[model samples]
Every structure is written in structure tokens, then in C-alpha cells.
Target: DVRECLARAGLLLEGAPVLYLSGYKGGQVNPAKGDFVFNCSAIYELMPTDVRLCQPAIFSGKVLSALGSIIAGIGRPMTDAMGTCGKAGQSVPSSGGGNMFLVIDENDEITIGGV
Candidate 1:
């Protein structure tokens, strides 16, 4: 998730002639302990077959899953932190940094810009 967001903001693929960001964060956790921190990257190139669309639904499930795992790790505190336990589980306390970008290729020219 961090890497994907970074790639979108043009922070992760500066030297590459072409780069794609894809997929979601995958990691392990222990309820007795805590969640796992990961360093990752995901890319999806803008191809004729795909419009390079970044849909919210594309990562929604994964986000929910990860959030669920985070909530589960906290156990009883989650019930209080979230106040509910549904399919998506509860929210956890978190903070992070990221960027958003819009990359455009015009006539073989590539322009990397922030979103």
C-alpha cells in the first residue's frame, strides 16, 4: 500500500523508463503481539487492454482484510476502538505518509506529475 501510493506519486520509480504499480500489501501478524510491517511495491501499466484505472474497489477488499487483521491483533481493545465487528471488522489507530500522482505519456514523452 505504501509502495503503490508512492509509485502513484512518482516517488518510487524515478529512474525507470516505464514502471507499473500493482497488487496489495501481504504480511503476517500475531494476535498476542502485533501486525507486520512491510516494504512493498505494486504496479499496473497503462496498456491497451487496460485503461490504467485505479479503482477504489480494486484495493477495498485487501484494505478491509488488512484492517481486520489489525483489529484482531488488538483483541478486546478493538471492540472499544471500533464499537462494532462486522465483515470488514474495526478500525485501528494508524498514521503514515504517502503521495498521489498522475503520469502521462505523450507521443513517446513521459511526464510525471503529482496528484
Candidate 2:
């Protein structure tokens, strides 16, 4: 899927460098209560794509990072990460939902990848 994703995005460029971060992101936010906390589990790697040898790799960064690096020279931050459940942890049942963004340098360690 990540390969297909990159292939679709046309980011399999030779001589182009890339940074990838894969992981889990979870936390709680309560604006009204003035409380906000979250976590980022970042898996980071930077490399060049061979296109021929590029496997799915399952890399995710919305192509924002790749595109930014390739086109604008600004690698977008990423996490492809998921979040914890519920608003203010109010629900009785445990579930998963919400959105969180995590950023890491190209070489930062701490990843969540591989299917």
C-alpha cells in the first residue's frame, strides 16, 4: 500500500532523498478544561528510492514530506500515527478515534511499521 501510495504519488524518484516516520499517536485533549496532552511514537528513516527496488515499504507521510523535499525542499512532518479513544476519555467503552500529528527529523528513531 505504501509503495502503491508512493508510486501513485510519483515519488519513486531516483537520486531523490526521503524521510519516513511510522508510529502510533495517542492522547487526550480538553480545550474547555484547559488540558491537552498527547504522545507520538515515531519510526523514522531517510533514504533514496530506486523505483526498481522500491518495495511497498509501507511508508506514510501523506507524501507531504516527500513532495516537500522533492519540490519545495521542505520535508513535511509526519506520524501516520493513530490516536487514543474518546473525548476527554469520557466514554465508558474503550475505542480508538481522533487525529494527531507528529513530527520527527529524518533520522529520529522510535517507529511503528511493518505489517
Best by lDDT: 2
What is the per-residue lDDT of model 1 for residues 1-115, given as tens digits with 9 covering 90 to 100? 4344444545445344333434435433344543333322444444322334333212222333344332111112222222322236654554332223223232212212221
Scored by TM-score, the top model is: 2
Instruction: Give the per-residue lDDT digits (tens) of candidate 2, residues 11-106.
Output: 535565444434425544454643433343543333344322222233333333333333321234444435444657565444432223222334
Residue 38 local lDDT, model 1:
31
Clash counts for the predictions, in order: 6, 2
Question: For each candidate, what TM-score against the reference?
Answer: 0.21, 0.30
The worst-scoring run of ten residues by lDDT in candidate 1 lies at 71-80
Which pairs of residues collide in candidate 2?
42-110, 43-111
Every model's Cα RMSD, please? 14.7, 10.4
